[model samples]
Target: MGRDAPAAPRMAAPAAAHAAPAVGDADRRRARDIHVAIVGGGGTGAAILHDLTQRGLRCTLFERGELTSGTTGRHHGQLHSGARYAVGDTDIARECMEEVTILRRIAAESIEMNYGLFIALDDDDVDYTAAFERACSESGIPNRRLSTTDALRHEPGMNPNARHAVMVPDGTIDAYRLPLQFLATARAGGATIRTFCEVTGIDSSDGRVSGLTVRDYRSGRDERIAADVVINAAGPWAGSVAALAGVGLPITPAPGTMVAVKGRLCNMVVSHLHPPGDGDIIVPQRNLSIVGSTQWKVDDPDAIRTPPDDILRLLDRARELVPAFAGAEFHAAWTAVRPLSGRTDAGGRELSRNFQVIAHASDGAAGLFSVTGGKATVLRAMGEAVADDVCRFTSLAIAGRTADTPLLAHREFFRRQERVHEPV
Candidate 1:
C-alpha cells in the first residue's frame, strides 16, 4: 500500500520531543459523537489509538493483559531498513524505509541508528550480493558494499572468514518504549486505554457491529460498551477475535524462537547475506546480543513453546556470522508469534511480510475491521491505513496527522496519575 501512497519525507533532523497537541473544544465534541473501540494493546493498537485521536476521533483500546504483554514485547527489536525483504518484495522494503525515516523523526528517543550489516558466509551468499544490492537500491533503501576488511572494521566481532558485506539503514528499537510512547501520546489526546480487560463478545445486529462485551479483570465484572466501529488489532490472535464476531480472518500465527546471550557482541545488527530465513538476524539490544529466529506456523498463539533445538540452531548460526557468539553466556530463550498475513502449508517463509486492513463488510459485518500482519517498523503506517479506511467507511473527512506529530516520551505514560484499568 505504501508503494501507492504519497511519497515519504527525506531524512531530516529528529522532531523536537513534545507532548501531544491539545484538541480543540469543537473537535473534541465532534469526535465524541462517534466512538471507536480497538482490540489489542500491542504497537499496532497503540498507533491506531494515537492516529485516530490525533484526527479528532473518540477512541478506546482494550487489552487482556498489561500493555505490550503479547507479541509486541517479545520481538527482537530490529528497526528494519527494508533490506531483509528487498530482494523479494520491494514495496514492503520501501515501506520500511519510509517508516524508518518517519520514526527517526517522530520517535527519535526510542531508536538507535547503529545501522546493520549483511555479511556473506559462503560462496552462495557472495553470489547473492549483486542482486541484493540492486534490489535495495531499486526499493530506495540506501546500501553500501564492503570488503571483508571494511566489514570487520565496522564489526570487529564478526567472523574473519566473511567473504564480504553490505551496509543498510537497519537500527534497533526499544520494543516496549516505542509503543508506550504512542500510548502516552494517545492518552494525552483523550484516548481511553484499558488494560487487563478482555473482550468476550462482539455485539452486532443486522450485519453491523454495535458494541462489545468485556470482562474487567481488575474489578471482576463484565460490562458492555457501545461503539460505532470495532477494530481488531490482536496480532497473532486476530483470527480468534474475528471468530467472536462471526467473521473469518486469514491470519497465520507463525512463531519464531529468539535466543539472547550476555554481552553486546556487535554494536550493529548483523544478518546472513542470503535470503531471509531461520536464525539470520542478530540484534544488539542494550548489553545483550539476540539471535533469532526459526519460523513455523501454529494454530494457537498462546500455546507456542520455544524449542530447545532452535536455541542450538540460532547460536550455531550466530557463530557463523560473529565468531564470539559461540562463547557468549546464554541469557534467555523465547518465542514470539508473528501475525503473518496468510495461511500456508509450508513454513511461513513464503508468506509476505506486508500487512493488510480487511474490512468485514463483505462478510456481513459492516462496521468491523481487522488489521493484521506487518512488522513493528511499519506500525505507524498500519495505523494510518486502518484509520483512513475507518474515515472512508464513516463518511468522515478527517485526515491522519500522526506522521508529523511527535510523540510523548514513554516515561510520560507512567507519569500521568489517571487510572487506565477502571471497571469497564
Candidate 2:
C-alpha cells in the first residue's frame, strides 16, 4: 500500500448535448445509446466497463462510493506471475500468467516492472523449493535459483538466515492508478460513470430485468435508469446485489488484513513459497512497504479492520524475511474481502480462484448476469469472458478487440489542462 496523495482533479461534466441518449434499442443507432448498467466500481467492474465501452457498447458504472473503495483498493500491490500458486493451485497460476502479461502490455502506466523473490530460510525446505521451482517451470513461468550470498547482496535487509531464493517475474502495481486509468479510458471511449450512486432495487416484469432504481447518496435523490442489461460485479457485495432481484448467489466473503509501513524495506517483492499464511509477502510501493496478509472468512465486506494480534503476528513473520523491518513505523492498516463462491461448508480457501459467469436466462430470467471470484491481476481476462456472454445475449455483433488495443495513450492535452488549473 502507498500513501494517499491528494485526490486527482475532477474532470468536467459532459455537456448537455453529450448526455446519454434515451433508452430505445432502435434509437440506439450509435453504441452510446445501448445502455448497460454495471453495479460496483471496483477493479473488476471498472475493467468490464472499460472493455464494454471499448467494444462500442454504451456503459454506465454505478458505485456506492468512490472508485476502488473496495477490495480492489485495499490489497498488497504485488503483481503475481502465478508462481505463488504453483505448488498446489496450478489453475490460478495459469490464469495469473496470462493476465499478468496482458496487463503489463495494456496498462503500462499503472504497473512497476520489478521482479519478485521467494526465499527459503532453512535447509530443511530446500527439497520443497526445488519441487516448487520445477512446477513453476512446467507451468510456463521462468524461475531462477539464487544463492544465499547473491540474495543477501541484492536485498541487504533480508534475514541472514535466508539460505536460498528463487527469482520470478513478479512486480508491484498501483491499485489506485489501475482502476482510475481504466475509468479515464472508459469515459474517453464514451462510457457514463456516476459515482456515489447506490443501486437500491431491480425493476423486472415478465421475469425480465427492465431497469434499476438508484439513489444519489450526495443529494438524497432517487432515480431510475432503464437498461437492456444489468451486471453484478460488486466484488464481495455480489450476493446482496443479487438479492435485490430476488435471486440467490452463493458468494462467501473472505477478509484479509494488511499493514503499510513508512518506507521500502526491500526493492522488490519478497514472498515465502509456502501455503497461505500470515505476512508471507512484502511488497515495495512508491514510498511505503506493504507487508501482509491474514485471510479469514467474514460476513460483511464493509466491516474491515486490522486486529492488533494479527498485526503483531505479521510483524513477527516479516522480521524473519527482513530483519530491518522489525521496528518500521506502522503507517496504516486496512482489510479487503475476497469474494468466494461455493458451499459455505466447503471452506473459502478451498474455493477455486477461477471466475464464474452466471446468466439468468438459463434459469428463467433474462437480461441479467453475475460475475464472481478471481484476483485483480486476472480482471481483464474475466472482463473479456463476461463481455462475450453479454454480446451473445444482446445479439450484438461487436468483437472483443480489447485484448489487442492499448487502453489509454499518454497525451499532452491532459497535462496541459492540469497545468492550467493546478493549485499553487
lDDT of each: 0.88, 0.77
All candidates: TM-score? 0.93, 0.88
Cα RMSD for candidates in order: 4.2, 6.7
Residue range 1-424, candidate 2, lDDT tens digits: 1222232223323232123333455434555456789999988898888778776687888999988998898868878888888777787788887777777766776777677889897665676887898888877787888887887777776776777888888888888777766666676666777778899998888888888999988788898889888999999999899889888888888888788888788887888866657799998898788888887887777867678888888878888887778879988888788887654664466777668889987554588899988888888887888888887887766666555555553342243232221111
The backbone clash count of each candidate, in order, is: 0, 0
Off by over 4 Å in 1: 1-29, 422-424
lDDT of 1 by residue, 1-424 (tens): 1222233232212232233335456554665688899999999999999888777778899999999999999998999999999998877899999999889877888887888999998989989999999999999998999999998899888788999999998999999999998998888667899999999999999999999999988889898999999999999999999999999899899899999999999999999999998899999999999999899888999967799999999999899888899789999999999999988888889889999999999998988999988999999999999999998898776678788877877887888637464332
Considering summed lDDT, which 10 consecutive residues are worst modelled in model 2? 415-424
